[model samples]
Each structure stands twice: as structure tokens, then as C-alpha cells.
Target: MADGSDPEYVAYVHGRAAALRRTAYLLCGDTHQADDLVQETITKLYARWPRIGRVDNLDAYVHSILVRAFLDEKRRGWWKVRLGVPPERPAPPHPGVEERAMLRAALTRVPPRQQAVLVLRFLCDQPVADVARALGCSEGTVKSQTAHGLAALRRILGNPLEIGMAR
Candidate 1:
């Protein structure tokens, strides 16, 4: 058995780890980077477990930590370093997979703050108020970011129809 194991903390981590990983993956679009983000977030959570335990919304607190960590990583110059060239590969054959790939590629083109806003609003189904609180911005900012991010995505994708925008 692990020394000084806190059952509550262990259970919380177990239940939320997958969700955290998925959010991280959407933010970074790389499984390895997502894993790193989750690991870092969990470590920070563990260190502040006592304070975090007292929070009314644990999920939101953890998400805030995760998002901030991702933003911080992006701000660091070392995070942009690529070690090797990529090999060429054929496109996905399935339409669904291809569409998802295209969407993700377009998402990567968005600024980090806009990407975070879009992910939190659409992917996580968070309300504008919640997103504002998480990003430490006003609700108006979240709404504007969502609009700008969608516009940027449409431009990058070059097919607004494909994004299913309402007329």
C-alpha cells in the first residue's frame, strides 16, 4: 500500500482523471501533452488538497488549475520546441474522422485564450458565467471570445457551412 494514502483524494483523482485528460487533450491536441498537463494539474491539486477540499465546486477549481497550467505552458518559450521532423501520412478515410481532424486543425489556429474559451463553452458545456469565472474575465469577454474564435475557425476552415452556424 502507498504511504499516507488519502482515500478521498485518491477517489477524487480516479473519478476525475479521465475528464481532465480529455479537456487537456482538446486544449493541446496531443495525447502526450495532455497527459503531461493532467499530471501537472494533479500534482498541483494534491499539494493544495486541503484548501481545495473546502471549495464549493471542486471540478471548477481543478479545471481552473488545468487551464492556467496550459496557458502557462504556452507562455513558456521551451513549450514550442519541436525535436524532429514529421513523416508524411495519408488522410483519414472516414468522413467523420476527417471532419473532426479538420475541425481540430482549425482549432489549433485559434489564439490560446480563444481556444480555451471555445473549449470551455462548447466542449465542456459551461455557461458564460462559469467560463468567465474560470478564465478570470468578464462574461462579456467570454461571449466575445466565443464569437471571435468561431469567426477565426470559419476563416481557417474556409467553409462556414461545415461549422453548422445558424443563419
Candidate 2:
């Protein structure tokens, strides 16, 4: 029951779902919320399929949408108050699981805007200019956000491995 227009869109979504889901999972720090994020982004993408499908950087467009969506949710006061929701039990630890878990916990401690900035810059390997453009912010804001986010992450993670040299 699909419109079947733009085979490339279909192919792109199929191929990139896992990657997008991983990014979303990192952004939201929850599997169910990550799934929701991907679903919402794909739905928006479907609505703009013809136009977005013609763009050379569809992945970037989708990522921008996801980040914007997360920011919008935060602005609407979703994270303003605690809802007393129980934390989901994490899976058993692997070799690097503890490190990753610590990172995720550190990420969740920051504001959503900082979280978006960090994930896009660090996790997605995007440049400051690209991140600023994608987030519709000034390059200075991107720099400040990157600095503060990195500082906060370091403080939370006990200054892990020299602030910001490599990911």
C-alpha cells in the first residue's frame, strides 16, 4: 500500500534505517523513543519524498529533521518536569558497554539542545559550519554549544581522554 514514487527514497530508507535508528537511539537514549524518532522522521520524509529525493544529501536532511524534532520536543516543555517514569533496565554489559553506558548517561544529563549539538558534532562527525547550517544557528552558537557540551560531558565522564581531540 505504498505510492511507489522515487525508488531511490525507498532504497535509501531501507538502507539507512539501521543507521538512523542508531543515531536516534543515541539522541533519545531509549530504544522505544529511538524507534519513535525514526518513525516520525520517515513519515515527514515521506511527505516530502519528491523534493527530498531529488536532493544530493538526503541523509543530512533527515538528520537535521531528527535533531529539529528533538529540539522542538524539548521546547514544548517535555523535559521540563519529571514524570516519575521508571528507568528501563539496561542489558548485560559487554566489553565496552560500560563506557558506552557512561557516555549515554552523560548525554542524558545535558540539555536537549546540547545533546543535539554533541551528537551531531561528535557522533555524526559533522563540522561546526555544517552543524550550524543544519541547526539554523550561528557558527558562534555552534562553537559555544560544542564547547559547553564537551565540557559538561567531560565533567560527567571525569574528563575522559583530553577534552576534544578525537571522537
Candidate 3:
């Protein structure tokens, strides 16, 4: 740190960059945009790195930065431009890929706060308390957002259980 850069920050970012990028992708559903989010998060983290030692959970702190960056971008609405149709990615050969793709698409339609809650609690398998801490909200709020988010997803995707019950 005395030499002008914190080695811990460098190592931390190097180790977690890919995971953060993946989380960003989940938040935005665009690879290029996800990269931008990660870059924004890393830049913010570097600025605050000197105080990292006092933090309780470093990963959660960094994740909070990434999510906030994503939410900020969504609020600005500058990335809505269509530079022509997006290129189609070759579908993965997994059996549930279609379902996952559908879910991802629906997720983008959900409100940002709810989407963040769902991604953190279910996708990342973080505890309710951890998610609350990362989002800077109460656990009750996280739980409520998650329920609303899931309901939105179910409505968007058409609940399979309801369909089966009707049959």
C-alpha cells in the first residue's frame, strides 16, 4: 500500500472479477453491459479500498457496489438504444437452458429492486441477512421484494403448476 497501490485490492479484484462479471450479466442480461458494470464496480472499489480493512464482509461490499452500478444504469435509461438486432448466441446443449433463458428474459422485466433481491437470495444463495446488508435494506424488505419479484416472474412465464392444475 505504501508503494502507491494496495496489493490486497489487486488480489481481491483478480480473484473475484469473473464472479462479479457473471453477477453483472445476471443483473443486466447483456455481456458487454455486464463488463461495463464490473468495470464501474472495480473502479469504485479501488477508490474505497483504503478503508476495506474495517469492513465485515468484503465480497458483499463489492457486490453491493456492482448492484448499485447496475441499478444506476437502469435508472439512467441510456443503454436502451438498439444498434440493430442483437446477434444470436448458439444455444447451450443443456436440457433446461430454454427455461433458464426464459427466466432471464422475464427477470429483466421485473422491477430493479425485486430483481436484485431474487438474484441475491436465490441465484447467489446468499442468506436473507446478507442480502439485506448488501442492498442496505431491512430483511423484511428483502423478503417482500423477493416475493413480488417471484410473482412477477411467475406471471411472465405462466405458472406451470397452475397450468397443470387446470388440466
Candidate 4:
């Protein structure tokens, strides 16, 4: 039998790479770090493609890999030292630049793990079970983290309901 390297693996990487990068960005809140994390995860997956390809839910499997990589990277010393620095806030969609900046600052203050949970659970709109699967934690952990993250966000930014109509 041949080793795992193959054209189909290359095609799969090309197809999923951008989406994986975006998911990684949402997970880590840093574009550069996100790119690195996606690359690392894809490299590992590529090396084990024979096994990985056999999984029924390969997309979910890859997502789990990305999330684990982001968490692992943060556990290392670099993210710890750089934690205080805010993510590069994108330009506001319209007026109220100050408000956007304030929100970004508040989100930056959130714990990285909390931010990750919120992004995956709320922003990405993943269900608790799926989020738990991605985070490699129990569903209870996802639920608790989501609750705490929302509470902290509300405490920092004031009532989301008061801000405006629910989007």
C-alpha cells in the first residue's frame, strides 16, 4: 500500500483551507495566529490522511483539530505574555466608531477560552453538543462556559437588549 500523500488530500486541503482559517480566526481572534494554527492542523491532518479520511464526519474532525490547536497554542507561554494586547479591531460598518471600539475592547478583555466558547457557541451558532465536540469538553462545560461568557459580556457592555433590537 502507498503512503498517505495523494492528490485527493491536496484537493481537500485546498478546498477547506480558507474556511478553516476563518474558523481559526474566530477561535483565536488573531489573523496571523489563525493562519498558523490552520496550517499546523492541516499539516498534521495531511500526514494522517489515511486515517482521517476514514472518519464519517471529517469536517467536524478537522474543526476539532483546529480548536485544539488554538487552545494548545494559547497554553504555551507566548499567548500568555501577549494576552493583554487587543485583537486588531476591524473598521466599523457605519457610524458609531467609538461604540465599535468599546465593544472590541470589552471582547478583548474576555478570557481567551471564554472568547473561544462564545465565538463557537453564539457567533458560529453551534449547538452545545457540537461545541463540546469541537472543544473536546463535556456538553456541561460548553453550557457553563457559554453562560458565564454571556454574563461577563453583558456585565461589561451593559444589556444587549437595551442596546438595540435583537439582530
Candidate 5:
């Protein structure tokens, strides 16, 4: 901390920084965003540091903080706001750009956690274990979120996107 955060918190964060960054990168898929996630997580840990002595597994507690920080960021969508003109997003790969556009719109409508799981699992093509690790949740949760995300996406898409269609 610039003003001197908790010494124990600083030490723990310094020691485990790389591991935390890897986990954050897995969650958000960007180095800059991962850095932000870690900063946020550490700030949160400092707030609870005095009472954190009772925590049985400190690593797990730190991870939980990181996950919540990531989830909260997603929910708040603060990053969507920018000071300057936003950079244009690259075109999606699908031949039917309109379909992909609609899908993107639908994705925005999904619950934040479900949307995160879907993006990491499908768009990022991450394995269940990796997604689980990134989210600090169980593989079961990843699978269920995937299922629920797909259902929500399909429902939003309506007749344009359907099940049992060949590619």
C-alpha cells in the first residue's frame, strides 16, 4: 500500500502475487485486467486483514476475495465506461455476423456469473477444471453455469438459435 497497508497482507500478497495473477488471467484473459483484479483483491484483503486470523486456509480466503472482486467487477461493468472514444471491437468470425451480433447482445443479458462461465468455457475454450480454478468454484458449478448460460442464450436467441442443429 502507498500509505502502508497491513504488513501481513502485504507479505502474503507479495509472496503469492504470481499465483494470483495467473488465476486472475484465467478469469479475465487479459494481463492488464488481471493486474487490476489482483489490486482489488489485495485491497479487499486489507480491509478484513485484522479479522482474517480466524480463517483456516489463508490461500483459499485470498482466492475467495479475488473471485468476488472479479465477479463484482463484471456485475458493475465499470470498465465499460471510458474517458476517450472506445476502440472498435474486432469483427466476430461467424459468416452470419448478424447472428453473432445477436448472440453478443444475448450474452450481455445473461447473469454475470453465468456469462463469465460461458465466455471462459466456450469463447476462451478453457477446460472445466481451469474454469473452476479461475472462478474459485467447483467443477460442478462450472458445468451447471455452462448449462444455464446456454439455456439462457438459446432462450434469448429464440428461433434463430436452436438445439440439435448440425453446425
Candidate 6:
């Protein structure tokens, strides 16, 4: 209802919120934290709607915002505060849940920047150039991060042969 309130911006947020939340969840491995990241990113987008609307790839721009938000959250010391252990819940009775859990656990062990690179490149299916632009790094840095991320994942997962390093 303010000056920045525009139909296109509303539509863009409506359309992309779920995807952004999913990406955030992958980065943080916690649904509540992911929601916070998405909310922060959306708040930023609303404040910069005029400028962001003119970008060639709005999705990429928003992704860059989301990734940066996650990184910034990591840099803050408050993120390390945990009051108590969460209640354990049974895993979903679905196929591939174990594999998904394994991958996610390994992902959590990776450094925040490398985790962002892996999530953007593999999970979001972003190209090296786009990822570099999003992370404000060079293409070569992205590539190196991807390699290191994968290697760390492999080491955590404990199967160098099983995990195929493709793309």
C-alpha cells in the first residue's frame, strides 16, 4: 500500500516465494531459518523494486539477494545460539529419504560460501557465470568452489566412488 507497492512486484513475489524458500532451506537446512531468509530477501526486493524490475533476469537477481542474506546470517554470531535440541521426528515414509538425508547432512558440513556455490550451481541449476555474478566472484572462483564443495561432500558422505562428480 506504499509507493513501492506495484502489481508486477506482487506477482513476482507470489510466483517465486516457494522456489526461494526451497533454495534457502537447502542453504540453511532449517525450515524456520529458511523462512526468515526468504522474508529478509523479499523485504529487500520490495525496497528496491524500481531498480530490480529493470534487470534482465529478475530471478537471478533475487537469488543473489537470497544467497547474500544466508551468507550474512552466517557471519553474525547470533546464528550459533541454540537454546535446546529439537524434538526428533520420524523420517517421512517416502522413497529416497535416506539418500536425501545423507546429502543434506553432508551439505551442512560444507563451508557457507562453498555451500552457496554448490546450491546455486547444482540445486538451482545456475550457470557458472550467473553464479559468479550472484556471489560477486569470478567464474574461476565459482568453479573452484564447486570442486571443493563436491570434494567435501564426498568426504563427508564417505563414498568417493558412489558419488559421481558430474557437471
lDDT of 3 at 23: 88
Q: Over all chains combined, what TM-score does candidate 4 have? A: 0.75
Candidate 2, residues 1-167: lDDT per residue as tens digits?
Answer: 22337676688789989998998877777899889888988888888886663566666778888877777776646344333765444775674666666667667777778888888888778898878877889999999998998888787678546433455
The 10-residue segment with the lowest total lDDT in model 3: 76-85
Q: What is the TM-score of each candidate against the true structure?
A: 0.80, 0.71, 0.76, 0.75, 0.55, 0.75
Model 1: lDDT of residue 106: 66
Could you give me the TM-score of model 3 versus the true structure? Answer: 0.76
Model 1 quality (TM-score):
0.80
lDDT of 6 at 104: 69
Give the poorly placed runs of model 1, Cα more than 4 Å off. Answer: 1-5, 76-89, 163-167
TM-score attained by model 2? 0.71
lDDT of 1 by residue, 71-123 (tens): 78876443233326452235878666766766776676678788889988888
Misplaced by over 4 Å in model 5 are 1-7, 76-110, 115-142, 150-167
lDDT of 4 by residue, 114-150 (tens): 7778888866778888888888889999888988887
Identify the superior model by lDDT, candidate 2 or candidate 4: 2
Cα deviation in Å at residue 83, candidate 4?
Answer: 7.8
By TM-score rank, best first, the candidates go 1, 3, 6, 4, 2, 5
lDDT of each: 0.80, 0.76, 0.78, 0.75, 0.74, 0.80
In the predicted model 6, the residue pairs found to clash are none
Clashes of each: 0, 0, 0, 0, 0, 0
Q: What is residue 11's positional error in candidate 5, in angstroms?
A: 2.4
Write down the worst ten-residue block by lDDT for model 1.
79-88
lDDT of 6 by residue, 52-109 (tens): 6467777778889999999888764432333265524468687467666666656766
